[model samples]
Every structure is written in C-alpha cells, then in structure tokens.
Target: MTAITKGAPRAFVLLRSRRRLDLLDPDPEAWTDEDLAGGLSRTMRWGGASQWEHPLSVAQHSLTVLAIREADGALTAGEGLRELLHDATEFMLGWDCITPLKAQLGEPFRALEARLQTAIDARYRLPRWTPEDYALHKRADRLAAASEAMHVVGWSRVEMRKTLGIAETPLVHDPLSPCAFAPWEPWPPRVAERLFLERFHALDHAHRSELRKLEPELRSSLVLTGAEHAAS
Candidate 1:
C-alpha cells in the first residue's frame, strides 16, 4: 500500500480479497470485482427490513433494475453496465441508506458518497448518464423499490404511496423471476454474490466487445481531426 500523507484523514477497511480500502480516500483499483460483489450481496436494502427469510440486498436490487431495463427493450452494453452498477457505491460504504435517511444525513455524507461513486465510475469506465437516460434509470429503480416494498418488504399499495412516498405502482411480476428463484424472494448472501458476479462479468465482456468494435472508427476520427488541424 502507498504511504498516506501525514495528518491526512484515513478510514480503512479490509476487504474479503485481503485488500485494504481507504474509505476517506478510496483507490479504485484497491478493491477487486469479487470484493464489490461480496460487499453488495451483504449490504441490505430497505434498512434491512424483510417480510421473508432474508433482507433484500443491493446486489439483487441492482440485477432487478437491469432486468427491468432489459424488459423495456434491448440495451447497449454500456447501458446495461450502468444499470448494474448504479448503486455500487453503497457496497463500498457498507450502507444503503433509504432516500429520506440520506437527506437527513446531510451534505457531508452525500459528499463522501459522491467521492466513492466517482471512484466506482472510474473503475468501471461507466458511461455518463444523459437526462433522458437518468430519468429512465430512476423510473426502473423506483419500480424495483415499489415491487420490493410490496412483495418483499410487506408494504401495501396504499402504504407504498402514502408512507413510502412511491407513486409508481409495484410491478406484479418480478423481472428476475425467470432466474428460477422464487418471485420477490431475497437470495442468501452467497447466492446473491454468485449471481451478481455472473451478471457483472457478462456485461463487462459485452461492454469491452462493443468498445473494441468502435476502436477503428475512433482512430479514423482522430486521424481526420489531425489532418484538419494541419490544413488550418
């Protein structure tokens, strides 16, 4: 590990991969993909509340969002990767605070999360979200939250709208049901970790393939720009 500058703030956590992450100043390469998958699988959503055998995990929630987006239409590899990692920072922080709670945590907490998210984005080379894309992502995220609240967290439709402040109707059919797990059932940590890693690797492969396909065009564009510069 690189030496921390004297007097600089540091909060370190040992990862499952036997790597240390400095939470105050995170190094994107310090944690492996497996570390992220394991952390996410253990990070509970809905403040760890559950109506079933286990609390819903951020890993499962991420897959749910990706599935929802896939159900909408075919997605580019980048889009799929974005959906899969939208909340990845929560895994590193070891907390998935509810929206209302996040507000209460104030700007300092938000800044910390933002720093961590920046690191995650760098690590994954995630695409930036356009306004329309961000709106779509939020819609899917809310839909997943609504469905999980109703089926997994035991919130009624009325309560979802009133108490949870979710206006979207919960999805009747779980998007991930096709995976052979019970509908809306939260998988155990080990199962969630395995599934999350599988999806991540698949998406990563496709994303890299797409990037490779674009490389020749990118080189041509760069060469054209250089010629134009010389002619000017």
Candidate 2:
C-alpha cells in the first residue's frame, strides 16, 4: 500500500494492488442488490458482536437492511452499487467493533481502512468519500446495527438500562421472539450465500426510486446492538 500526497489533501491508499471483488465478475453488468454479501458475512469474532446479538454475520445483517429497504420501494442500479460497497473495506480491514476500536486501536486501522476503501472505489468506479454517500450509507449501516441489536440479539430495555447504562427504550418497538436465538435462526453458510443472491434477484429494481431519500423518523428507531452468546 502506498500514500501519495499529490493533491492538496493527505488521503490514504492501502490496497494499491489488491483485486476487486468478483461476486459479479462474470456479469459485472447485472442488476443491483443490497450491500455486499461478503462484507456482511464478516464474523463477529475479534469482538464484533454487541451484547444483544447472537453472533450474526454482517452479511446477514446487510440482507436484513436490504430487505427492509426493498419493502419501502424501488432503488436504482447505482443505489444498489452504493449499498454493496458500503462495507467493502471489511474484506480487508475486518469488522472492528465500535467501542473496542475507539478505545483501543484508534486511528491506525482507520487510516489503513481509508486507503483500502479508496482502492475499492477506484477499482469499482464508484463515488469516493463524498458527503452524500457518507450520510446515506451511515444511516443504513447504523439502522441495520441497531435492528440487529434489539431484534436478533435479544437485548431488552431493562438490560440496556443495566448494562449499556442508557435509559432509552432501545430501537425495538417490541421484544425478540423466543426462537430468535435458536440455532435455527442463523442460516447454514452455503444457504446464507444462496439466500443473499436470492434476495438480490427478488428485489430487482423495486428499491431504486427512494435511493437517496430515507425517512428520518424511521431510521431513528434503530440503535446499536450486541451480546456474548455462550455456546451450549
């Protein structure tokens, strides 16, 4: 990885030589889909899960986000492209959970990640760190995170009060189903991949119209989520 200060700014570049993802290599011109599958498949190991979630993969969570977004309306091919790259850097930087990273790793990983992301952008011909994309993706990512915390992880308003030390009601309007944590909740690895493609094909062009617009009231409900699930 190399950093060139050609412009008046000091941007980073970590993956100067890495290959762009090939999920759609055979048909790079195919229809769009929600955030990247591989990115979400990212594991919760290395302190990735919050206390409420059951070690759900980022890929799974991304699917949920895509599903919810599709339920709203149609998104464009470009919007789908944007969503897919939202977490693309995870392929290289790995999912560094928020608290641990801010308190421990700090700026170094972020610096490298910024570089890797640049390479991803250049390779994919997508927009770079523009303010609009930043805001849009952050909203979806955070909303997805919060939804996973409250819905999938099984955290409660009381638990949130006791542990996270927040008096807020949490993003969930209700509690998790008893079956939510069942082993059956998570799909088998291969099935998960197939499901991602399935949903992508299913939602084709249905979510394009609302690409850049999201309801503030709706996303406001999602909050960060996680938990340490003890394997039985």
Q: Best candidate, TM-score-wise?
A: 1
For model 2, how does the per-residue alpha-carbon lDDT over 1-232 read when each residue is reduced to its tens digit?
Answer: 1333465344321222332332212122221232344434544432544443345664555565554454456655555655655555554444645554555777876665666666655545553546875665666666555555555565565775676544434344322122324422444444455566565454433433243354453355442122223322
- Taken over the whole model, the C-alpha lDDT of each candidate is 0.92, 0.48
**lDDT (Cα, tens digit) per residue for candidate 1, span 1-232:** 8887998889988999999999889898999999999999999998899988889999999999999989888999889999999999988889898888889989999999989989988888788999999999999999999999999989898988888789998999877863657899999999999999999999999998998899999999999999999999
State how far residue 23 of model 1 sits from its true place (Å). 1.9
Candidate of highest lDDT = 1
RMSD of each: 1.6, 15.5
How close to the true structure is residue 30 of candidate 1, measured as C-alpha lDDT?
92
Estimate candidate 1's RMSD in Å.
1.6
Q: What is the TM-score of each candidate against the true structure?
A: 0.94, 0.53
